[model samples]
Target: MALTETPLLFEFEVVSSEDLTFIPMCVRFNLDRFGLRISLAQWQLLPYEDRRLLARFPVDDDTEIEPNFDHALFEMLRTHANVEPEWFAPEEAPAWRNVSAVPGGVANQAGLADLRTPDIEDWAQLAPFQRYVLAKLARKPEANHDFVPAMREFGLAVPRNAAR
Candidate 1:
């Protein structure tokens, strides 16, 4: 099926439920890229139905949507909805390509190196999504501080920062 590109009507505010704070840079990037200009109050006021609809539709290539929204909203709305978020690093993400095969790029770099061991049979037990998230997080230098904490929370092994 051909991918249908849709224009956005409502601007999104990148508010962190964890912090109750908005990341202005991320917000501006989404707005400028998607042609949206939504306020915090406006976002809060949106009915669940409308939010569900917006989340189901595809934005342009440059826009960023909430990760959970990308997965849950689309899957709930339509079987054919493309649920992948723009932030998702592709299989060939730079970090994955650059690291040695032994390290295996992002997954290894992110402290999930233990995942690569054949002797540790449990390593193969992680869900694909967990593996994907771990790999993506490993390659992102910006997420380094949060990566180990997230790994612990997710029951993944932590990697030491050799640079420190």
Candidate 2:
């Protein structure tokens, strides 16, 4: 029998004025109809220990249903945090020229020394956004372990830098 992998659902909260004010424009538009505004400084005043409690509130599944502002307010007293801005950017983006050319394709300057064809092909197959992310990760000195495994899983042949 095969075990199914469950998608991880992160329980997030908007628990402070800072979190409320800092929410991205997209989420802010959704929250505005309920007349909610979160301020960052207000959130800083709360004790850190109580912050996680905000996740106890379950998210509603209805796309059309508005968020419960009163509940949102209560949660804010202890729970909101901002998502990293970088997560929203395209993966293979910040469009720039490739650093070098291998037999079949080009590599970004960051990936020049350790060229791997299968890896290049695998990366090429991804959406430009995803390619951007892999390229960025590959170039990071601290990401060597994680990057190699990800490359192998994507069916890419290891580059010469594998031993490094």
Candidate 3:
């Protein structure tokens, strides 16, 4: 996982459900980078403070500490939730990190939504979390109402009225 700046929560994801009920995308992105899989059940088991700690942990490439966020997160999960961590080694560069081209699935989803597909330049310029959010949103059409709003938030798309 590349170390780039990312917000803990995107404006598009500030809905009521996301604050505590839903796992925020930034935490999920860090978990992905760490090769950890945390179920929603396990998340609900963790106290709010633990969840806040996980949200604030640093995974940026420039951090000086060794074995920083992941180890601490694992321990926290075990201590607070009594849950074992599960791992799925992510690709060295996941789809979101690839700036060469937008993933076909994302492009297809954009087309389906009547929105512009972000070009290579746009993708290349996005913060890592923004790309991660887009990739996640594209995976299931049923949960993808946020796709257009997210794209607009990322400045990759404009509202139809504004485009006229």
Candidate 4:
């Protein structure tokens, strides 16, 4: 399938035509909401089709319906990789969900990258998925070269970068 056919996949994430070496933010976002974690090794073990399916899986947010993502992913892991899925407690209040303020990590990273920091109004305007993507990109454990690209993609004005 063409990469664009996978709506959750972003242009910045297209490291190669078909090499999904890194987990896309869309998969991460859904997994985070479901409170499950899959290792990179585990992800690589799945056939490309399954990886694409997981990336395409929808976030089940309807309170009135039973959520199936956790079970489906678990089965996929068990069937494909012969391993159990790891778990984490989902955040009671994820920073991205709080539109009242921009997370400090994101703001700090923007400043460090010499990009315009998003204010509350800007933050509020972002779709939840966009906010989630930003929160993940802003994390400091690694050098985040994608932050500028992501900001530009999300319609945020990033000035010329001194850090690039």
Candidate 5:
């Protein structure tokens, strides 16, 4: 028999389900970043304190979450923010090569020295997967302490009075 090509691998379709509505940490992060600008009328439509709380999330160095949104959160976001229903592209993502290594340059900043552990230059040589892992870890709301530290290490913004 002649050799045959490998299979195309499993195929699947992703559909939204009624049981859950989800947004990833990174998307949440970006939404909170440039999403809150609004006329007072639109702002008033938001649940009291919910808009305030949403403003802080997925962004380190802001006040911690002190309120939660209703199940209508996704709908609220669409109405309040001037973004398309499904996609939002704020800025070009960090270039792959530029993002290749850990942002080793941040080592010299205050409180940013911890990422330099084991060896000072070690971070600059991390593999792409390592960088990717760090990137995902960098976006989690619960992991803001870790993320902001990395952000500072990368010369990215750290929230005001972030030392807390």
Candidate 6:
């Protein structure tokens, strides 16, 4: 049987930076529980030109729906496909708040003046990264450009202007 034909698979967009020149980019993934670990040396092994070229996303198929990485194929191709988990952005990784950054003025960043409401429940229930963004916005009220947008986008904040 074929590989994509199998069941246990899923996908998500992975944002990354080789951090070389700072041209932001993204990659598509067809994921499985089995992991792949790629190294900078492995990446560097490519010809310098090839390395640069590979860092770029293919324009023709810019938004590809990658097939789930089939386990059978993974088992068959494990030796050749030493996939690395390095490509995923920290945002996509488990949400780990940067303690040193000190985002919010108070402990409950999401419960800020504009963000909070009687309808809302526990602020601590939010994901750490979600709390971090809101916390940062709360600290520098001047940087509230995305404050309402972030809140509404995440479905966490009900607009003060909206009628209940």
Clashes per candidate, residues 3 or more apart or on different chains = 1, 14, 0, 0, 0, 5
Which residue segments of model 5 deviate by more than 4 Å? 1-24, 29-74, 78-89, 95-99, 104-113, 117-144, 148-164
Off by over 4 Å in 6: 1-120, 161-164
Give the per-residue Cα lDDT of candidate 6 at 144.
45
How does each model score on lDDT?
0.37, 0.36, 0.73, 0.76, 0.36, 0.36
At residue 8, what lDDT does model 2 achieve?
Answer: 12
Off by over 4 Å in 2: 1-78, 81-122, 128-130, 139-143, 159-164
Per-residue lDDT tens digits for candidate 1, residues 102-146, read 224444345343332211333345443334334544554443544
Q: How good is model 2 by TM-score? A: 0.31
TM-scores vs. true structure, each candidate = 0.33, 0.31, 0.81, 0.85, 0.26, 0.30
Q: After superposition, how far is residue 72 of candidate 3 from its true place, in Å?
A: 2.2
lDDT (Cα, tens digit) per residue for candidate 6, span 36-139: 33454544443443333333422121113323333323342334445434333323421224433323343244444455542323345555545544554456
Which candidate achieves the best lDDT against the true structure? Answer: 4
Worst 10 residues of 3 by lDDT: 58-67
Best candidate (score: TM-score): 4
Itemize residue pairs with steric clashes in candidate 4.
Answer: none
Candidate 4: tens digits of C-alpha lDDT, residues 30-66: 7888778989999888888777767766544331243
Q: What is the lDDT of candidate 6?
A: 0.36
For candidate 2, what is the lDDT?
Answer: 0.36
**Residue 63 in model 1: lDDT:** 31
Which residue pairs clash within candidate 3? none
